[model samples]
Target: MVKYADDFKAMVVQEYLRGTIGYKVLAEKHGIKSKNQIVDWVNAYKKFGIEGLFRKRRHEVYSVQFKLDVLSFMKRTGASHAETALHFGLTNPSMIGDWKKKFLEGGAEALDYPKGRPVMSDKAKNVKKNQKPTQQDEMTCEQKLEQENELLRLEVEYLKKLRAFQMDPEGYLEKHKQRYHSNSKKNSD
Candidate 1:
């Protein structure tokens, strides 16, 4: 699943190791964006040799515990993402960063979240297509009340904002321009 081929990585690593060129020059010559990328490739090459640069055919899934262990190891040892990945035999160091972000935002259970699209078997798809709504799918009294409360709260908030805008459209827009700009930037991206 590697992006760069092993041959290309080897060539870059060898060129860098030759001492005639630095990472920045090599990265620019090869159209790579970051010098850090070359640093990682060279580190991997030095640590694991040519085999480290080879592409993996199959995707590897790490268990939640294994992910937690990797994060903990990094935390304990103060290793960089690339170093931690090499220590753990992980090809992609960015995955460790993602795991750390998810863990920080949602704790260990977030590590258990599935990646990629959900695959439905033929039988399951057929069953889902033919299934009709059942009482079990219906909201309970408390859930119904909660939904109503949420709707009412949103309506009230919308009305208040509408009133403010109606009173002073220019002022309201000026007040909210930053929010609008941020939202537009997100949508554009």
Candidate 2:
């Protein structure tokens, strides 16, 4: 995504409103990639005034319920992403599209987690645990070697499949359809 300065956006919007030039010419003059960018800025300016032109510094986390509500409202009213976003006081309309795509692909549970790395918990910060060694720690050398060999075999199989997927994604997915479905069904059960 391209980040434009608020002043530059305001200037473009102002120039567009002046009515002497259209979006295409203004976009070409200002070296903007898309004419639709001007349209979005103008609409945002009209609906939200100057504050709409400003960039957001921090990400605002929305609840899963809120995302569902936005999607439901869009479906119920048959509103476009831009209209729904404006009604919800959301700065970005594309977020609605993204949510809809995710919901369709993975259902509502997919929206339960937010993007980016999770924060480290206090428990994770502690180096030592108040627990005794497991049975694996007391295993004989022969047993440990057998376990390590089994792990190596699994890793080799995993790498083979990974290479196949990277080489031919569509073919790999088609081949693994049964395995994927079975694993998902087992988890659900």
Winning model by lDDT: 1
lDDT of 1 by residue, 72-172 (tens): 55664578999887876666788899999997896665777787778899998999899998988899999999966765664455456657766776787
Worst 10 residues of 1 by lDDT: 180-189
Best by TM-score: 1
- Candidate 1 residues lying further than 4 Å off, grouped into runs, are 1-7, 132-189
- Per-residue lDDT of model 2, residues 48-86, tens digit only: 799877766677777665676567557655878877776
Give the clashing pairs for model 2: none
Model 2 spans with C-alpha error above 4 angstroms: 121-189
lDDT of 1 at 164: 71
TM-score of each: 0.61, 0.59
* Model 1 lDDT, residue 19, Cα: 100
**Candidate 1, overall lDDT?**
0.75
Worst 10 residues of 2 by lDDT: 180-189
